[model samples]
Target chain A: MAVLTDADIEALGLTLRLATTVTVLLLLLGLPLAWWLAHTRSRWRRPITAVVALPLVLPPTVLGFYLLMLLGPDGAVGRAMAALGLAALPFTFKGLVVASMLYSLPFVVQPLQNAFEAVGNRPLEVAACLRAGPLDRFFSIALPLALPGVLTAAVLGFAHTVGEFGVVLMIGGNIPGQTRVLSMRIYDHVQAGEYHQANVLSLCLLVVSFAALLAMSLLRTRRHSRD
Target chain B: MTDSPHGLEAKLAWRSGALAFDIDLSLPAQGITALFGPSGAGKTSCLRAIAGLEQHASGRVSFGSDVWQDSSHRVFLPPHRRRIGYVFQEPSLFTHRSVVGNLDFGYRRAGRPVHLDRDGLIDRFGLRPLLERRIDNLSGGERQRVSMVQALLSDPALLLFDEPLSALDGAARSDLMGCLESLHATLKVPMVYVSHNVDEVARLADHLVLMEAGHVVAQGNLQETLTRLDLPPALGEAVGTVIDGQVVDYDAHDQLIALEFVGGRLWLPYRHESVGQRLRCRIGARDVVLTKAPQEGTSALNQLPCRIVAVADADHPSQVLVQLDAGGSTLLARITRRSWHELALSPGSAVWAQVKAVALGL
Candidate 1:
């Protein structure tokens, strides 16, 4: 028997695409937010940080349920989209991407924040003294110094989004070739009692997860020895 | 000294959690001005305020005619806008860049001034060979050398140094001092150097500002400031005068160099200085002994005919500080009260000041 059926191959491709889009979007959004969170002394920082970390503790179903409500036809966001003459985002690939971004926000933001904090004020001050303006200092000094954390954030975010099942199942409804990701495909095979297909899909998901984590660890060790 | 009437005029008052001080200064525009004091006396604060580093510094600061800060008018130029190069105790270089990258970091940011002699600076600081090396690969002294060259490449109007050599060891300290002296002679830019090392101040400073407990005790020519008898007790061991003497002759047979200053001639152990070259020497107060008459066949290498200018109580009761005029130059002698009374020394009394050692600064 073929290890992966055509449907399984389609699900794997969909999962990789979804993971890649969410990771890129989250990184772009996370860099600035994480930089502000690292450097700001405002009293609101604590509460904002707590809100970003909520997904880490909230069960995936709970977050997906809230997102489902917010994106449902009767919800405020859904109403705004309708007013803009846009389709609602439930049980669709676009909805899955949105859910995954929210679920993986902390995985990307926390590492970047830690990295920015580690790059103390001295280098920035030196840059300022050297006549470098604010933006130049950030891009030329602080960002380069925090590069390792950026890569680690990417790996963790991509891996975490790939492993997600509950949120994708809730918002995407497991439609073949569209919303059925690798994790949900494994679930579909088990439900149909196809042990061989289920085992093949499950092994694929496990191997991808392991490879990602091993890459992150290797990047971390390399950074440590470089320092 | 070119005596430019307007140099750096600053009246600043700064107060932080652990330290505070108020200073009013009119520094020279064309030489190294050492802000001399003990640690925590607000020397660094003064330097920072001048560089616009102290955000809370209130009062007026003007370099020549450019007003850097005026709290009343709410006119404050940020550090980046102020064309000043500042060097801290630690090199604090950008670790991500190599030495060449760091040297270029400021140079390029400063618009790569066409007048800046990049090749000469790299050659002067001996940085040509180390340009491609990583910052971490440098030794402490080499790092400071790079730091200095990095600051200079920025083409600043004024250079502010905050105890740049206090972090160096003996060998590195001398090496950096030599570099500083050479830079002083080569560059026309004014400098504000903050240091507590008396040797460094005497060797490097043309003008001196003495700070004590966040207050200015005295500010004047370097020799006059050091010769002041009324300085705080904290300046006890640092009391002395610097003199510029000409090298007259060298006795290679006996290994001695004859030096001539106003009102006297002296012989020092030879150190390969050419004749007619000016040698700078620091004679500490504690290194001199006053005698009513010169002793024949004495091992003491120097004796100068000078008159007692004044006398004051030394830091200790048993010792007295005496000021003397050697020809046209100034000298100071710290001696025992018993000797002062035995020799009957007073203003206008003629005497010979027997010197023990003369410190040569790099």
Candidate 2:
């Protein structure tokens, strides 16, 4: 049986890096979108919410297939990147980042949206009356009050990105130390009939994901009791 | 602070689904103005409009010279821009922050000079030990006390209270009542208070705006409005008269204070109010006894010579409510059909009103 190799170590590092990048990007992009989804009374609220939540139900392979086409060399985004003197995004580290962000969008946004909704209107009204403007109220009141939800979102987003396989497989074609994350390395090991190496990588993913989900559930229960 | 000579003048109209409001009121610039009405009467909506919290409301609101809202001219100042402090029905203290942090949220945003600084309010509201405590541990009354202190610390030019004490039980309500009274005495900020309880309105409001079905049926000085014979019928049986008086003397031996009004002197249970301090004494119609002539044998503390101004139908068909003009002030007396018929009461008949009891309103 092969011991923990340098290739496995690099794959682990790359997975963590991609998950971190994707989680950070999702939080930045998802917070305002979640806030709008939570509070808006507009006609578009339901449709927009449905679109943001589509990833949860859509097959990851199908999503990956579409994303592959979108980032392919004659695609609109691909051509624009080429015009800007940049390589096409597919099969690159940056391409994996984009794919992971989409895969984890629902994981980050749903909890945050629920958290913002749970804050209710009364606190914001009180803050407004207390001379807190919109931004001031969000940072001082909404953000802090919704902290538990934010934590859940972060954990779920990071974990989901870390364990992601189909989207990464389709968009991030195996490339050592670039887009060959742990899941991809595990796939490589299993296809080569190296069952021991595959089992090791798979166990690491299972343990980490389980720990993260356990923490999330514990956080949720604590929050519910506090309420 | 700018003197709001016109007090608060709002001509606001709001429509949300089936409930709609059309209100035009001019409140006194100083002291508390209680918006008295039943639920769904649009009292809160009107108050929210004045505070710039009701989005659908359109019209003008001018506090003295400053125009807070004028939809016609598109001059609408948002809530944060307007120096108004509003306390909601619930005590919405920041759960994540310590008490001191919650207080500082308003204090830091207060661009105007601090009227009551943090330590000063903490001392005044007895919140020193609670400064570092988390808000979740506070009782309902304690949370409301902190809320009041927070609003006061901001030094609001105009304060809006929407049933701030409704969430508290009897003891907590009275405790916050005392705090509110003291805060009103200290700050003297123009306040628009919304309440369904008539007792609260009688005790705190200097100006009264009566609303029903989304309309201001009557608005005037609290003393005058309460006594007005033609008040909106929606006021129902809570109708009473507010007699403005002063504590001329306190009979220490009798445990009563001599409250002298324009009509006469009423001896009521002495509170801690000093002599010469003004008071608003609420005498309910049910509490006033009508007599043809002043009698000396009765144990009642007050009897005033009054002329029957009008005899109106009471909500209960069995009773007739007689309006009496005692000297310059007005008094309401709910007398039975037997007494009304036996005494032969008329619009201009001479009579003496015996007030058996008077509840001191603030």
Candidate 3:
């Protein structure tokens, strides 16, 4: 009996592509959102914070269900996309990425928010007096000081997306070479009584999750020691 | 100095936590203008408003021809847009950067023509050796030096210092003060220094603004304002005279130098300053004694024949403050009520004021 097959390799590759795409998109979206959440003195801060933090407490299935409602063909976003000459997101790799982003939103944003908040007003003010404009201050002073937090956010985002199972199962139905990520693949193996294939894939995921956390911790330690 | 084209005029009105600021100020074109007051007296607020650091500060503020802030016209330039450099109470150096990094942070951003000599300033401030060091590794004095060098590197049109030395120990404080006094002779840009320290103010300020409880009690030339009798009652103890003159005579054996001004001459212990260089000193009112005639047997070495200018009540009920004019320079003498009555002194009465050589603050 073969311990692994071509299908398992395809699932691993697909899982990586989905996690990479979602992590990149989350970072791009999360940077500014975290900055605003950290510094804005507006009255909407509490409500918006609560909304960003919703994924932390809400079950992954709950988020996936709501997203499925919103991004399905009859849903608001799905209708808008369809009108703009786009395919419906459900049961596709795109749907998995979209759902994973919502599921891992807090993991990405919270760290970045804490990082930017750690860069308090004094350094920015000092930079301004040195003839740096607002944007210049943000890039040169605020962002660099929050580098560790940024790294933690990126790692957590990538790992959380990789480990996510419920949202991917609900909105992104199992489909080989498309939405059959490692976690869902393991589920399919267990259901089929292919214990050997399941063990190999599950070990891969376990090692990957452990490595991601260890990498984040090691980077944090090196940075603190260097400082 | 009045003919110089640049000056600062500001009217700051704002309210921050637990403090309200309502101050109107006019500073001269050159030399140091000190905003002197106690903590929570709005001295720092006045400097911040002038530098465009306080966003909510309203009313008009103009530096030279540049209108820094005008609420009615909706003209307000932020700190970076205004050519002003600010030094806070504590060194606000970027911790993530090295000393050189902090120095370059402003130099690279400053718009040309910089017109400032970077290496000379670094050398003057003694920051050359610590260029590669991290900010966290620097001592308090060294950090302040870096702050000063960093500010000067930006080539700012105006510099504002907010109690830059209050955080340092005595040795560091005097060392930085030495740098500032040396820098003053060669510095071209106008500066605003805020401090509650009398010695720092007296040593550094050519002009003074006395603040008390969010109000400007008096503002004038350092010499004129310090000798003013009608300053706020809380500042009555600061009543003294500032003298600026040339070192005409130096007796090396006695370690004394004769400082001669338009009015007369007084001697102070020499501190290695060569003759013909100008120096300044402050004489406290309480250090002077009044007598009807000059006494030869007195141990006091500084005696001047001065005509009385004014007599006012001092802070204590038993003492009186007498203003005297030794020709053109003004002097203040604090005497008891009994001495005032026995001498029968009135404005215009001629008398001899005796000041101890050791009492002069050089």
Per lDDT, the best of the predicted structures is 3
For residues B216-242, write the lDDT of model 2, one tens digit per residue.
888777877777666656786668887
CAPRI quality level assigned to candidate 2 from its DockQ score = medium
Pairs with backbone N, CA or C atoms under 3 Å apart (clashes), candidate 2: B7-B29
lDDT of 2: 0.86
TM-score, prediction 1: 0.92
The parts of candidate 2 lying over 4 Å away from their true place are A217-227, B1-4, B112-117, B249-254, B271-277, B296-299, B358-362
Q: 1 or 2, which is superior by DockQ?
A: 2
Q: Quote the lDDT for B316 in model 2.
A: 70
- On lDDT, who's better, 1 or 2? 1
Runs in model 1 deviating more than 4 A are A74-76, A84-86, A170-172, A220-227, B358-362
Which scores better on lDDT, 2 or 3?
3
lDDT of 3 by residue, B1-362 (tens): 53265688888789888788888888888889989877778888888788887888999998899998999999999888887888989989998899999998888887534477888888989888999999888999999989888888787888899999999987898899999999889988889999988778888889899998877889988989999888766777678888888999999899999999878899899888899999888888999998889999999998899999999998889989999998898999989988899889999999998989989866
The CAPRI quality class of candidate 1 comes to medium
Write candidate 1's Cα lDDT for B258-339 as tens digits: 8788778877767668899877778889888788899898778788889889998999999988999999888988999999
> Looking at candidate 3, what is the lDDT of residue B332?
92
Tell me candidate 3's fraction of native contacts, as a decimal between 0 and 1. 0.78
TM-score of chain B of each: 0.96, 0.91, 0.96
lDDT of 2 at A170: 91
lDDT of 3: 0.88
